[model samples]
Target: MNKKTIAAAFVAVVAAAGIAYWSLGSANAPLRGSSVAAASGNKVITIWRDPGCGCCDAYADYLEGNGYVVTRVDDPNFDKRSIEAGVPQQGIGCHLAEIDGYVVSGLVPAEIIERLVSERPDITGITLPGMPANAPGMAPTKTGTLKTYAFGKDGVTVYSEE
Candidate 1:
């Protein structure tokens, strides 16, 4: 090929690579939090997630849509933080959250969260464990039952099955 054709080909390849990189980077970028304050009676939930996981953002959206005021923080070391917050290694989820005084892990359902706040269970927090495909925010529609476990100074125990 002529010099101009070769140069054009190189430019095209470079442009394509740049676009691909930007797409991936933005996908993993930390999500911005909502500026709107929660209404008088709304519950406020703060979630910390790995910036590389898209599902965490979806989970935040799920919380917001369910009437909770959600705040998201992108922490690449979220798992370590979860452990530090008393979540067992085996019970770690994709994201970690603090609602009222309890730590919530993974894609737990909104109603369960509401129940936690209402029941005021004496525990450090509740977790849904690993990323279940049918869990809220993980899938469009939930199917089957999801067992949520509570962990605290005592130990991990079954919180509920929804």
Candidate 2:
């Protein structure tokens, strides 16, 4: 072959090799592994809430509507349990949830819960204090003035204004 012909063949070979490597890397790439249930298409989230709390049930329904297969535990000891689980009084909400490994409390929005699962922040959990009317499962009131807080061992801080 002429020198130019040989150079063209070499470039083609290099391009082919690069394409092959890209395809293999793409095929063997690791998944995000955010939700164990999402891998199997179940997308389940476990929740613990007070039995008599109507808003807690409403939150569960909202989660269910947003693709979470909710397993609710209505324990009368919800207050004690949340405290035991590291949820502070100032950070209290309507219910407690475990999504993947992170904690979710009160009437937090479904989108925020999804973000928590996806981002996996190094915190105890997220909370919507006092069940604001405009929060995910809370009753819609005039102002919708619920305050959402993020809680961890360090302390609680307001996360969002609802």
Candidate 3:
């Protein structure tokens, strides 16, 4: 092939590959993992955290272990993202996660997170402030004490005790 023809073909191939990769793995794509229940349908959670935060990685692992399709975003502007997701001032945690129309602030357990999906509460979302001892992804403590709160424009209220 002539140089011009080869270059054009190469560009075409590259564009095709880029499009395919995006469609298959983009945040909006449907869940592909067997662990996720069909009811959830590729229920992926996108988490925004500080790049150097190790606990955030641990939290992501915990979610994956429970079958959640997780997407990790090490954003320098993570705090802005969390606030934009509507995290209450009192509910801010080490990391922020966005679920189906819900903002999860902090180290909430997979169970609580799943419950939010299952129950489909009317509130905006839930929060686990202060990386509670024994909270999923944090060092397990004997007390296992953590407080989960539900919050929205009306403000924050107790969601549950764990």
Best by lDDT: 1
Per-residue lDDT of 1-162 in model 3, one digit per residue for the tens? 999999999999999996676434433333222223325576678777888988899888878877877788667666666676777776788887777767788888777877887888888788888767677777742255578999987888899796
Off by over 4 Å in 1: 1-40
The CA lDDT of each predicted structure is 0.81, 0.68, 0.74
TM-score of each: 0.75, 0.68, 0.72
Total clashing pairs in model 3? 1
Candidate 2 ranges beyond 4 A from true positions: 1-35, 38-42, 140-146
lDDT pick, better of 1 and 2: 1
Ranking by lDDT: 1, 3, 2
Output the better candidate (2/3) by lDDT: 3
lDDT tens readout by residue for model 1, 1-162? 999999999999999996665323332333222212222346787788887899888888988888887767778888888888899999999998877668899999999988988787899899999999999888986788999999999999999997
How accurate locally is residue 117 in candidate 2, as Cα lDDT from 0 to 100? 65
Error of 1 at 18 (Å): 44
